[model samples]
Target: MSALDAKKIAEAEALMGQVDSAPDEYAKAGMYFKAATAYRLAKSSDKSKDCFLKAIDCYENNKSWFHAAKSYEQIILLAKENGTLSEVEEYANRACSLYQQHGSPEAAAAALDKAAKMTESKHPELALEFYKRALAVVLIGDATHQASEFASKVSRILVKLKRYEEASKALKKEISLNLQTKSYGQVGRLVVALVLVQLAYGDLADAKKTFKKWGNRCEHQEVSTLQKLLQAFDDGDQELAAKVLASPFIRHMDVEYALLSKNISMPQCIQNGI
Candidate 1:
């Protein structure tokens, strides 16, 4: 280990000694937690986990939630008694959920973030499970901003799951939440995403409708540009298409053009219409 790591281990051992002899339960718990932190810094998570568990025991025995939260957070890191991968995964998830029930939205969000990352690489199903779990806690918790943030994340996970319909629905829900919260920037972003998802599902008519709805709600340059472009495309008017191609609407046409470009063949109707 590096000198810094060795020093942290030494400090943790010292704190553990103090925790062993402290008369006050709160003080003992705090010391144990400190020891765990130091051990964690030293890259000794296995050894550090014991100190955290001890801190949890101490805090719970004293009914000190403030410290209990800190200890539970560390216990989640340890995850299991013997630390099997799946066992630890379940333990962390359950413990984090319990923390959320106790009115800790931030804690729950943090744990869910970790869970999402863990499941993303090795098991997407597991990632989605954690994403849903996090979504449940965020919706129930009092952290509106955090909840909205997690909602955005859940939308991404659903997309990864190839549940395109569900992803579109989730995106729409997030847009509504942002509207209700008066988070104009978030609403703008989600509206764009919603449009893209709709377009992805070949629901051009619905996408057009939603684009119009959002255009009326927003005065953003980007939104205006998108509305014009979508209207132009829907109209199949050469003049409107020419206008869009020459205007800011070009950027807004990217998603549509990207998809359609790949499979584009001149429509017989367009030839007939002209």
Candidate 2:
């Protein structure tokens, strides 16, 4: 009846003609995509899906996630799948979100990672959403230390987003949850984060105190809590430096210290012995 509607029908008919006449699968796929677009414009979701499914089948056979994701979104919208999708994000991210909603976090995280690497800084907000979704799925139904470890990773991304307040809150929540359950490794991680946040805010004394409270509890020597202690010292916090050196966490640093001392002592010993 309307010019726009008629135009769309004409386009759909033309695409259908191509679909019927196309000699090869690729050509048929392209025609189906075009017909699907026209059907979508005409509010014919079922017809759109019919054509889109053909397009998607071809795309999947070709191993093209980009186009497959677009077609899958149409399928998802027509009650074929349950999930959320935002076309404004990257193609892989759309697929990732849908996969996450369908309870496949690992698959979702993988897709999100691919999209994140390709997007660069162009879509930080979308990237943050993917990271949050990954954390949520990883943490779900798990009361163990791994959940807290995942929380730390999520907090790291939040800090990158300059969401410092949220990062602090996340760290505090992780600490409280793990400490209540006696998840010492997680508590250590939280305390270390708290110390870093304090140092970021220029509260050297508090950072030093927090580190002292947590340094030896989780056997944090593997990660070298001394690295952070040295940072405090480098920042001219002499009292913090003294406290850190006296702390048990630094005891493990003896090997590194000895190596340095040996290098210096070796030269002198060699000079004298020679």
Candidate 3:
């Protein structure tokens, strides 16, 4: 490290010591916040995160949840820069929780959503968890539309991860949320996704059942199409299934399902001449 940076970090630690001995929590919060900034100037992100956390403790002790949440969010940014992969989720989760306690559920969800988008490419499973947590945060209020929106995000990540079973479950949850708000059109769209996921998961029986579950909800629009598609797969008719997959409904679905359509094939047992 540069000599200047070393000096700045040392000064930051001294500020921390002063905060520890301070009798007034408000003053401690201010000192810790300054120390956090000093450590950041020193290019010592780990130390910066610690100081922000200390600031959060003091702010929360003074019933300053908004300030505490803002400070905790600084730790999230520092963690993204220097903390371990595991630490990223931990810090983000705690930061969102603090925002929730501050009566800012939307802020909490938005923070996690940003973190998830940033992490999705390199750490999709963790990104999926973040999206799920965001959905939970949104569901804490009566914001049914927001809940449905986040739930769809959760399902999309699960699909991108190729966790078809989990994707089906997530889609089902999203459908339920939409139903609660009488969002029939949204439910219809998710119905197609759910059946597709069930099919991709190689659960023909469940696929049939799921299609039937939404038959009335979808105004029976997808019934015959799903039936023909599912039947083609059932009979191990790859050509027919491939043709069915080419329908505009499959082609125009979400990007994830659209990609899945291109890759769908009969199981190896059938391909291997079983």
Go through the candidates in order and give the clash count of each: 0, 0, 0
lDDT of 1 by residue, 118-148 (tens): 5566566777677677777777765566667
* Alpha-carbon lDDT, every model: 0.66, 0.58, 0.82
lDDT by residue (tens digit), candidate 2, 1-274: 6778778878988889767677776677778888888877776667877888888777666656556665655554543222223432544556765565555666655555544443335556666665555556555645445556555555666565656556667677667668766877656645655655554444556656666666666454624764646464445555564555555553443242322212211122222433
Quote the RMSD, in angstroms, for model 2.
Answer: 14.2
Sorted on TM-score, best first, the list reads: 3, 1, 2
Runs off by more than 4 Å, candidate 2: 1-93, 100-103, 120-125, 141-153, 172-190, 203-213, 220-274
TM-score of each: 0.65, 0.44, 0.81
- What is the model-wide C-alpha lDDT for candidate 1? 0.66
lDDT of 3: 0.82
Clashing pairs in 2: none
Which structure is stronger by lDDT: 1 or 2?
1
Give the higher-TM-score candidate: 1 or 2: 1
TM-score of 3: 0.81
Instruction: For candidate 3, list the clashing residue pairs, or say none.
Output: none
Model 3 lDDT per residue over 1-274, tens place: 9998999988898997887688899889999999998998898887787888888889989988778877866776676667455667876887788888889999899888878876888898889889888888888777789889889888998888888998888888999998998888877767777877887877777877887787678755566677788788777788888888888878888898788777667786654546
Global Cα RMSD, each model: 5.9, 14.2, 3.7
Residue pairs with colliding backbones in model 1 are: none
